[model samples]
Target: MTEDLTGKRALVTGAASGIGAATARWLAAHGVTALVLVDLDGPGLAALDMPCEVLPFPGDVTDEALWDRIEAEAGPLDYAVINAGIAGGAPIATMTLDEWRATLSVNLDGAFLALRCATRLVRDHGAMVLTASVSGLKAEPGTAAYGASKAGLMQLGRVAAKELAPRGVRVNCIAPGGVDTPIWDQTPFFQEMIAQAGGDRAAAMAALSGAATPLARFATADQIAAQIGFLLSDAAGTITGTSLVSDGGYLL
Candidate 1:
C-alpha cells in the first residue's frame, strides 16, 4: 500500500545524491509537501527539481552551528532521514588516526548532530531513519573505520528510539549491504574495480555484488529509499529501535 504523506514535512541529510536524493524524491512523490534538504554539494542539492517545497541547506553535517541554524529556521518535521555519510576502508594496521577520525566525524558525529535536531523538532509520532551499513554488523577485513562508525550509528539509533518512545517518536536504522550509489565512486577501491572492469561501472558493481551477496546483485538507490520510506510510514508505527537490514542475504 502506498503511504500517504500528504501535508507532511521531512528533513533529509546528504540530499545531494545517492540514497539521500532518492529518499527525498521518494518522499516528494508520496505527497510530502515540505522537504528540508541538507548537503555539502550545493549545486547537486539545488539541481533536485521536485514537486514539493525544497529548502536546500548546503553545509557540512558535522558543523554544529549549521545544525543549530537548521533547528531554528526549519519548522517542525514529521520525518527525518539522517543519512549524510562517507565511505572508506583500510586495514586497521595501516589506517591512520586522521582517516579514522574523518570517517567518524561524518558518519557518526554528523549523524548525532542531525539526530539531536530531529529529536527536538520532529513532532510526536514522527519517525526517523539512520543509514547504517552491513559492515557494522558483520566484520570484514579493511573496514575498521567505516564499520565502527556505522556500528556506533546503529547503537545511537537504538538509544534514541528508547528515549523518544515516550514522545511517540520512532527511530530505526537501515543497514544496506551494497547499493548502486555515488558513494562508491568516491572510494579508491571501487574506482580501481571500475577501471579493472573496463570502465563499466555497472559491470564492476555487478561483479562485486555477485561476489559478496548470495542474491548476486546489489540494490538500487530507489530500493533502499523505499525500505526507508516503509520504516518511516504509519505502517511501521509499532516498530522502533530495530534495524531493517536490506543486505541481499549478505549476512548469511
Candidate 2:
C-alpha cells in the first residue's frame, strides 16, 4: 500500500478504459477521496463502483473550453493523469490531413489541454502524469502519426514541469509499450499482432511475450497503473519532468 491520498481530488481524462481506468482504480486502492472522471464513455464511468466521489463528464479533451469548464467545476486536485489516446498508422504520403489532425488533437493536443487546466486547479505542489507510449521512442513505417504525437507528449511533460516547478508542481510522462487492453480487440494492429504469432492471437500474443523486452510479455494495465499511483503519491516527491516507460521491455 502507498500513501493514502485521502483528502486529495483528481481528474483523469480517458478514465473509462484501459490504462486510464486502471489508474483510477489503483488510486482508489490507495484511498483517494474525490475523482472527476472525464471521457467519452458516459455509461462506462457511471458504471464504475469505487469509494471516490466520481463526477463523470462526457466530452473531448482537445477543446480548451472543456478544460476551463472542468477546472471551474472540479475544484482543486492533487493529481491529474492524461491518458486518452488513439492509434493511427499510415504512411505520411497516404495519410489524409484530417487523419493527422485527429491523431494530434487527441493524443498530443488533448494531453496539453488537460495538463494546462490541471495546473490551474491542482494544489500548488500537486503532481501530474501524462501517458505517452513506447511508440514515442521508436518510429515505425506505418505509425508515424501516432509516434510523433506521443513523442510530442513526452516533450510537453518536460516543458510543463519547467513551467510548473516554480509553482511547486511536478509533471512527468509514461511511455508504455503494449498493454493487454480492450482497445487491442478493436484496433487493426491487433490483427498484425496476431499475424506475428502465426495467425493466432493467443500465440502471437505469446510471441510478443518479449524475447526482446527485458520484462517479457505485454504489460497489463494494472502494471502501468501501479507506477501512476506511485507518481501521484508522496513517494515520488523528488521525481518530475521525466518519463516512466512501462512496455515490459519492448524498448529494451
Candidate 3:
C-alpha cells in the first residue's frame, strides 16, 4: 500500500543536510502540511525550499532550552526524525577524554534529549526514528568514541520504545553504513584517510565501499531517508523497538 502524509505535521533534526534533509524533502513530496526543521547550519536551513510550511529552527539539538522553544512553537507533531550527529574519532589509546565526551554529547545525549521531548509532544500513534550507525553494531579500529556513542543510542531507542509503547508512540533506530553525505566530507578522520589515498576522496570512498560493503557501493542519503519515512508512516505501525540496518550488508 502507498503511504501518505497529507496534512501531517513533522519535525526533523539535522535537516540542513544529509539524511535529515532528504527526509524533510520526502515528507514534503508525500504532502505533509507542516515541517519543523532543526539544524545548527542556519544558512543551510535557509537554503532549503520545501513545498510545505517550513519552520526552520537553527540550533543545537543537545540544548534543552532549544527543545523547549521548539515544543512551544512547533505545535503538535505527528512524526520526528532525530538524525543530528557527528562522525570521526580516534583510537582509545590516542583519544582524549574531551573527544570521547564530545562524541557522546552530540550523538547519545542529543538523541536522548530529542527522544524525551518527542515522547511528550508527539501525538499518540505517532512514530520517531533515530539515526544510528553500523559502527554501533560492529566494531572497527580507530572508532572507539563514535562507535560507543551510536551503540548507546541503539540501546536508548529500544528502551524508549518500550516506555512509550503504552502511549502508542513507536520508537525505532536506523543504523546506516557509509553514505555519501556531507558529514563524511566534514569528518577529519575521513578526510585524513582520503588524503592518504592519493588525495582523491572519491577513489578512497570507492575502494572502501568495494572492500567492506557486500553491495559494493555506498547508500545515498535519500535511500536512508526512505527507510526513515517508512518507519514514520502507518505502513510500519507494527514496528517499534527495532533497529533497521541499512548498511548494504556491511555487518554481514
Candidate 4:
C-alpha cells in the first residue's frame, strides 16, 4: 500500500501464515525488491506466489546458526521482522521446563538472535520489528510462560533500540491482541482454555475480538502487518525502543 520500501531488503520469520505472511505480502505489494522469508514451513513458503523477489530460507529462528546461514544466503538486509513465537499455558507450578524454555527461546531468544544478526547487515538507515502480544502488558494467570516471554521481548526491544539507535538502526516491537492465526491450531492450550472456561470454541474466539474494542473489531493480520511495514519504512524514522500496540484498543 505504501511505497516506502521500494528499494529495501527485508526478512520476515514465522512467515508462513498469519501476521508474518500478511507482512511479507504487503511488503512485496509495497515494492520491496529483496524479500527474504524464513520459516520452518518450507512447503508453505515455497507455495507462496508473490510479485517481489523472495528467497525462502527454511530454519529454526531459535537456532543461533540459522542467522549466520540467512546472512550468507540473503545478502544485506534492511529490515528484520522477528515474528516467531510459542505459547505455553498452564499454572506456573504445573508447566514443564521444556514448555517454559521453548516459549522463551522462540519469543525472547529468537528475537535477540534475529536482531543481532540483522543489525550487522542492516544498512545504517535500517529498522527491525519484533512481534509481541497484548499479554506482554496484560495480566493473564494461565499464560505465565507465554506472557513472561512476551514481556521480556518488549524489554529486549527497548534495550536493542538504545543499543542500536546510535548506529541509526531503529529497533521496536508490535504487540497485537487476538488475531486470527494458525498459531491457535499449533497450541494445545486453546482447547484446554475452552474446556476450562466452559464455552463454545467459536464463541470464545469471537469474544476475544473487539467486542468491547475501541476500534470495534479484532485486528486483521494485514492491519498488524501494515504497522510493521510502516515501522520498517522511513515513516517511522523517529520511532525506536517502543512497543506499539496493535490490539484494537483491548488495553484501553
Kindly provide the TM-score of model 3 when superposed on the true structure, using C-alpha atoms.
Answer: 0.96
TM-score for each prediction?
0.99, 0.92, 0.96, 0.91
Q: How high is the lDDT of residue 9 in model 3?
A: 90
- Give one digit per residue, the lDDT tens place, for model 4 in 29-88: 888898899887889899888798889888888888888888777888888898987666
**Ten contiguous residues with the weakest lDDT in model 3:** 184-193
Report every candidate's CA lDDT.
0.96, 0.85, 0.90, 0.84
Predicted candidate 3 versus true structure: per-residue lDDT over 59-95, tens digit per residue: 9988999989987888888898999999876879988
Say which prediction, candidate 1 or candidate 3, comes out ahead on lDDT.
Answer: 1
Name model 1 segments beyond 4 Å from true: none
Off by over 4 Å in 3: 196-199
Candidate 2: TM-score?
0.92
Best-performing candidate as measured by lDDT = 1
Candidate with more favorable, higher lDDT: 3 or 4? 3
lDDT of 2 by residue, 1-252 (tens): 448788888888899989999999988877889988988788888888888788788888887887888988888888999898887787889999999999999998898888888888888989999999889998768888899999999999999999999988889898888887776665676678886767777776666565537777788899898888888777888999999888776765
- Lowest summed lDDT across 10 adjacent residues in model 2 is found at 204-213
Cα-based lDDT at residue 174, candidate 3: 93
RMSD for each model, in Å, please? 0.7, 2.0, 1.4, 2.5
Model 1 residue pairs with clashes = none
Which numbered prediction scores highest in TM-score against the true structure? 1
